[model samples]
Target: MFACQVEVVVLTCEPLTMGEERYYAAEIVLKSDFVNGRVGLQVSLEDLDEWERCLDALEAEAGAEWPTGGRSAWLAVVPEDPVEVTVHDSPSTQIAVRMPIDVASDWLEENRLRLDRVQKAVATVS
Candidate 1:
């Protein structure tokens, strides 16, 4: 298959309640050289699950704290050139949002549930 590098800049999940519909919506800013510079992608519960699967693989292959080459996020994919992706997505039915799904998931798991989120709720303005 194609070899590419993947990393996640940010991952966030917010509890949403709209009438009877309630769910946790998420946003993931997956950073990769293969696709755009910083691809801000959205994620749902299913997406988060998908990402966790990738994270599991990374943990199994590498340690929990994977080397980031002194970078903030871990290296999601191992190798690839962005140019090739551009070529493959050209012409009819041609478009690519080259986000490494697994990497985003790993980022989510790594950054999910923090201590600071337990702080007091925001106060309403008078």
Candidate 2:
């Protein structure tokens, strides 16, 4: 059993197109700071399929009994393995975390009422 508490200050959700396929994914910026900036984690392109699969499961259930139910379902979709975290331009500076999806879902649920920060960052970055 492993978990790490991380503060997601902003998320960059964007559409990725590859030939005939399009994926909607997000890059989360952690509040964990470095000398110059904060550490970031990108939801890998392959994981976009996982996100869609989780969404499909939600639809198949015909909606959740409560909002958090939906979030937990999504969290449960994460593979039970350590996810790679890397710092750009620093190939040797790599790290990993377990239960990333559960952590992210928990954060989202906690801050469900304050999505304006994420939305604003997405708009500005896009």
Candidate 3:
């Protein structure tokens, strides 16, 4: 029997006058051979346009090449079927990405390209 699983880990950094507060949120889903592993991550933001802008800024800062622009970053994993995206009213903005456990290493490596930019951005605020 084939076994597969998917999980999502979100790391959010909020900057303050003195320092930054980082929040980590995670969700795990498992599937057996009979079922295909599926996972979705919801990113909440006060404004949809702002959320897109934030993601665009992140991509531009990272200078990482994406075939479909920054879509890969948030989708993380290209599902066989369309994944639903929900926008809601919230005080803070968030960006969520989902991926399969087996390819977690690959995802990490792909994302690591933005480490320098992320660090730089955080440093500027702190």
For all predictions, the C-alpha RMSD in Å is 11.5, 10.8, 15.2
The TM-score, computed over Cα atoms with residue i paired to residue i, of candidate 2 is 0.30
Worst 10 residues of 3 by lDDT: 81-90
TM-score of each: 0.32, 0.30, 0.27
lDDT of 1 by residue, 1-126 (tens): 122255333444555555654444443344555444322222334444444454465445532322222222222342222212211122323333434333333333433333124111111110
Model 1: residues >4 Å from true position, as ranges?
A: 1-8, 18-21, 30-47, 61-126
lDDT of 3: 0.32
lDDT of 3 by residue, 1-126 (tens): 011254333334343332233322211233434332333333222222343444454434432111222322232222222222222112223533233334332443344544445456655644
Candidate with the larger lDDT of 2 and 3: 2
> Runs in model 3 with CA error above 4 Å?
1-5, 18-100
Instruction: State the C-alpha lDDT per candidate.
Output: 0.34, 0.35, 0.32
Candidate No. with top lDDT: 2
Report model 3's TM-score to 2 decimal places. Answer: 0.27
Tens digits of per-residue lDDT for model 2, 1-126: 112444223334565455665444544344443322333333434443344444455434422211122221122223232322222322224432212323443432343333444445444644
